[model samples]
Structure formats: structure tokens, C-alpha cells
Target: MFSDRLGAAAQAIQAQFKHTLGQLDDVPVVRAMRHATHGGKRLRGFLVIESARLHGISSAQSIWAATAVEALHAYSLVHDDLPCMDDDDLRRGKPTVHRKWDEATAVLAGDALQTLAFELVTRSEASPEPAVRAELALRLARASGAEGMVLGQALDIAAETAEAPLSLDDITRLQHGKTGALIEWSATAGAVLAQADAAPLLRYARALGLAFQIADDVLDVTGDSATVGKAVGKDASAGKATFVSLLGLEAARRRAADLVSEACDSLEGYGAEAETLKEAARFVVTRAH
Candidate 1:
């Protein structure tokens, strides 16, 4: 059901953008945009909708929020795939944005997508209040900015060459900044839109965020590229910091389980609506794809 919801929402969003976005040329920029936005699984969007439903929020409003978050996620992938970042050649079984188009075009496409994300949320058919839109924009910016993802990435790069080996704590800090913050924001944004108290969910998101990254580490060590859709074992090969690097695989797995338990506990009062989210936490640790 969770995956179904994600796929259905992604279809709707794709329809919403079909033949839109103005004069899209066949230029490198447009190609980059198409590559980055075309095939995402849109897990972030699903989380938004599901979390909103848990709080009795309108589906339309959730859709607006979800689409906006997904756009930014697409933007991040575009930039992350650049030669300057992950420098990957494939994503979702296709050439990455920068691999299909020139670096400059990829960069511009990412910028446009990021800005478009905010615009969509603010202008949605069932938008949140202006104040809510403002908050969303602020949160997204902070999550993507130097204080968050970018900085975390910088830490990752440096740890690759730093004199000291990365500790488990360092891995947590990096994950919180890189993967965890966006995931948390996606969850919190949904709660915010529902006019629900975000505190519990935010804490839940934090634990889930860390668990997700640790599971990513395990996958990198054990999964194949065909399943992951990206280079596997790149961290170990590159000598980068990872939960696996800091803790042995067995220990990392245990830590991820602990994080999942923490996440589930944070939902003490959310009742059955939170069942999906609880499953998501376990899924994060156990998924093969």
C-alpha cells in the first residue's frame, strides 16, 4: 500500500507537469531536467501524504506539499550527480542528469527545479496558508543549504581525506545533515500542514533518518548495483566514512534496529494511522531496493 500510494502520487504529479514549465527546449538544460525528474520513486512525497492523512489533513494540501518536496529531491539528485559531487553516470537505470547533459546545464536545471519546488507548494490548488508556505520554504532552504545537506556532503568529502578515521558519531552527524534532515522535514511538513503538533513526528523522523542512513550503509556493502540503481560499495572503495566504517556490519545492523525502535516509540499517541510510518522505519532497515 505504501509503495502504491507513492506510485499513484508520482503519476499525478507527472500529469500535473506534462507539457508545462514553458518553452522547454531540447537543449542540454532541458535534457538534464528531464533526466532528473523523470523516474524518481517519490518516497518523500508519499511520506508527506501518509503523514498528513494521519492528522486528518486534506489530500489536496498533502499533494501540494508532496509535489514540492519531490521537486527539491529531484533537484538534489541532479546536483549530487554532477562531476563535482557524486559524479555518478547512472540513476534509476538511466544516465544521470550531468551524464546526459553538460555540467553547466545540469547545474542550471537543478537550480530551476529547486526554485520551482517552492513555487509549486506556494501556488498549489490546495495550498497551505501563506504562513505555512513561508515555513516550508524556510525549512527546505535550511535543509538544502550550507547548514545542512551541502555541509554534510562537504564533511563526507573531507572525511575521505582527513587524517583521523571517522567515528560512529561523525557518521551520525553527517547522515543527520545529508539524508536525515530532508526526510525529517518531509515528515514535519506534513504534520505542519495538518495543523498537528510536529514535535513527536520530528523526533520520530530523526531516528528514522539515522536508521535510513545506516541501512544505506548495509546495502552499499551487501546489495548489488542493479538493485540499488547506483554504484554500490563506493564508500568502502573510496575510504569514506560510513556507519559500516565506524561500526562493523553486525553492530551497524543492530544500531539500525535500535533506531527503528526509537522511531516507533515516538508515536505513542498517533494510534493506527502511524502504522504505515512504523512500517516505514522497519522497511528502511530491511529493504533491498
Candidate 2:
């Protein structure tokens, strides 16, 4: 059931993204945008849709938020892969946008995708209530902007040049902004759309997001580039501190498992209705990529 829901969400977002990108002229920038957003686990989108389902929201209305987050995520990836950034050569098992096209086209495509995210979330189709749409757009900007993901990225960049590796506390704080912020937004967006209280889901997401990053660190140590779909062992090579670096491998694995348990526990209010979410948290730690 979890796989089915995940697959359905991925396909739905892909169609929405294709339809939206189709409106633009067939050019390199547009092609790059399409390529960049083409595929992923679509876990963020799934969280939005599933959380919406838990709140009795319609998939039609929730799909916009799903696609919006995916577009924003794609933008982050494109920029992150640039030579000046992570200098990654591959993503999702395909050539990075900057590698496939020129740097100029990659930049433009990322910029376009970022804007498209807001457009998708703010569109009337996303929610009948203008207030809800406005809230979604506002929060999305906060989650993706300097105060959130970008702040984390900035800190990460600075850490590369720091005299000492980051402490566990520092990395946790950084991940809260860089990765946790968007996950929190996606998980809570459904409650916002339905005018329901989001505190529970917000708690769930905070634990899930950190555990997700810890799992990535674990995979970096244990996975190969082909299996992980990107470069592996980068933190070690760069001498950057990560959960695996701070905590031993066995300890890091235990921490992620504990966090997944915490994440699942946070959904107790929803009972059986949240089984997929529980499964999702488990998957975050256990996934091969």
C-alpha cells in the first residue's frame, strides 16, 4: 500500500510538472528544467498528498502543493550540482543539469523552476480559498529561502573552510534548516489546507527529516555511487563532519532507528490512518537511495 501510494504520487506530480513545463517554448532552458525535475522518489510530494488525505482533503486540491514542492526541490538540486557548488556530475542516475547543458542554461532553468513553484502553489486550482493559497505560498518562500534551506547551504559552505569540523549540535542545527524545514512544510501543508491543527504532523516531520539525513550519511559510507545515484563518500573525502563522522556507524544507525520510532510515534493521534506515514519514516532509514 505504501509503495502504491508513493508510485501514484510520483506519477501524478510528473504529469503536473510536464503539463506546466509544456506551456513554455521548446528551448534548452525549458528542456533542462524538464530534465532536472524528471524523476525522484517524490517523497516530499507523497507527504503532502498523504497528509492531505489524513485531513480529508481532496487530491485535486493537494496535488498543486505536491508539484510545487517538487519543483522547488528540483531547483535546489540543479543549483547544488553546479561547479561552484557541490560540483556533482550525476543526480537520480542521470547527468547533472549543468553537465548535460551549459552552466548558463542550468542557472536559468533553476531560476524558472523556483518561480514555477510559487505559481503552482498560488494558483486558484490549488485551493478555492485565497487565504489558504496565500498561506501556502508564504510558508513555501520561508521554507526554501534564506531562512531555511539556503541558510543551511550557506552554513555548509562555510563549514568546508572552517578550522575544525562541525560539532554534532552544529550539524543538527544546520540540517534543521537545510533539510528539515521543507519536510516540515510538506508534512504540515495538508493540515493548513484543511484548517486543521498541524502540530502533530510538524513533530512527526522534525524527527523524520533528521533521521532522513542521518540515513543519507549512513548510505554515503555504505553505498556506492551507482546504488546511491550520486557521489558517495564525499563527506569523508572533503573531511566534512556528518552524523557518521560524529557518531560511529553503529551509533548513527541506532540514532536513525530511534528517530524513525519517534517519527512514527508522533502519528499516534491518527492511528491506523497514518500507517503509510509510519512506513515512510521506516523507509527513510532503510532505503537504498
Candidate 3:
């Protein structure tokens, strides 16, 4: 059921993307933007939509927020795959933006996508209240900018040339910034939209985000490139410290399961309405990509 819901969400988001991007100019950068966002699990967007659902928000309104998060996520992946960053040639089982297009096109596409995320979140369709839209934009900026994802990326790059591998605590802190920030934003977007308290979703997202990163580390070691849709074992090959490297494979798996439990527990107050989210948490650690 969770898988079905996830698939539906992905389809809806992709449709939104096509409709939105279709209005843009026909250019290489625009094409690259479309390509960069073509496929993925759409987990962050699903979190946005599902969290919004829990708050009784209509899919009509929440789809904008969900699409915004996915656009931003796509932008991040495009940049991450550039030569100066992760330098990968594959994503979502296809050639990455930089590989499919020129580097300049990729850069411009990523920039355009990032800006489009803010535009979508701030659109009148996303929310009737200007304050809510403004709040979403503000939080999105913080999550995707210097204080969040960028900071994490900077730390990751720094770790590459550090005197020694990062300690577990160090890696955790880094991941909290890089991966956890946007996830927290996505998971809490519903409450924000409804002007309700986001504390429970925040707690759930923190655990889920960390677990998501741990799962990614596990996949890097245990998954193949075809299944992962990206380069595998890059961290190990680069001698980069990861959860699997720091805690061994089985230990990392157990830790992910524990975190999934913690995430589900944080949703207890929502009762049966939160089952989909709980299933999503479990799915994170078990997914191949």
C-alpha cells in the first residue's frame, strides 16, 4: 500500500513538473532542467504531500509545495553530479544532467530549478495566505542555502582532505546539515501550511533523515550501480567515512532499523492516520534506490 501511494505521488509530481516546465522557453538549459528532474523516488515530495494530507490539506494546494521540494532536490542532484562535485555520470538510471548536456547547461539548469522551487512555493496556488507562502520560502531558503545543504556539502568536501577520517559524531553533524535540513523542511511543510505546531513532524523527520543517510551508506556498499542508479562504493573507494564504514554493515543496518522505529514512534499521536508515514520510514532503509 505504501509502495502504491509512493508510486502515485511520483506520478502526480511528474505530471506537475511537465505542466510547469512545459511553459518555459525551449532551450538547452530548460531541457536539461527537465531531464534532471525526470525520475527519482520522489520521497521528499511524498513527505510533503503526506504530511499535508495529515493536516487535512488538499492535494490541489499541497502539490505545489511537493513539486517545489522535488525541483529543489533535482537541482541539488544536478549540481552534485557536476565535474567539480560528485562527478557522476548517472542518476535515476540515466545520464546525469552534466553528462547529457554541457556543463554550462547543467549549471544553468540547476540554478533555474533552484529558483523555480522558490517560485512554486511562493505562488498564490500554494497557499491563500501570503504569510504561509512567505514562511515556506524562508524555510526553504535556509534549508537549501548556506545554513543547510550547502554547509553540509562544504563539510563533506573538507572531510575529503582532512588529516583523518571523520568521527561518528562529526559525520552525524555533517549529515544533519546536508541531508537532514531539507527533509525536515519537507516533513514539516504540512503543519506550516496549516499554521499548526510542527514539533512532532520535526522529531520524526530528524530521525527519518538520519536513517535515510545511513541507508544510503549501506546501499553504497551493498547495492550495484544498476540498482542504485548512481555510482556505488564511491565512499569506500575514496576512503570517505560513512555509517557502514564507521559501524560495520550489520551494525549500520540495525541502527537504521532502530531509527525507523524511533521515527514511527514519534508519529504515535497521529494514530492510524500516520500509518503511511510509518511505512515510508520503514521503506527508506529497505529501498534499493
List the candidate 1 regions with Cα displacement exceeding 4 Å: 19-27, 124-128
Per-residue lDDT for 1-289 in model 1, tens only? 6566667878866655554454566766766666677766666777777788888886667777777777788888888888878889888877887767678888899998888788877774535377777777788888878988888878887887899888878878888988988898888877777666899989999999899889989999999989888888888888887888778899999999999999999987888878888877888899886
Model 3: which residue pairs collide? none
Off by over 4 Å in 2: none
Each prediction's TM-score versus the true structure = 0.93, 0.99, 0.99
Residue 246, candidate 2: C-alpha displacement in angstroms: 0.5
Worst 10-residue stretch by lDDT in candidate 3? 96-105
Greater-lDDT candidate between 1 and 3: 3
Task: After superposing candidate 3 on the true structure, give the runs of residues whose Cα lies further than 4 Å from its correct spot.
Answer: none
Mind giving the per-residue lDDT tens digits that candidate 3 earns over 1-289? 7889899889999999999999998989889988988989999999999999999999899999999999999999999899999899999899998888889989999999999999999999999999999999999999998999999999999999999999999999999989999999999999999999999999999999999999999999999999899999899999999999999999999999999999999999999999999999999999988
- CA RMSD of each candidate after superposition: 1.9, 0.6, 0.6
lDDT (tens digit, per residue) of candidate 2 on 79-141: 999999999999999999999998999999999999999999999999999999999999999
lDDT of each: 0.80, 0.95, 0.95
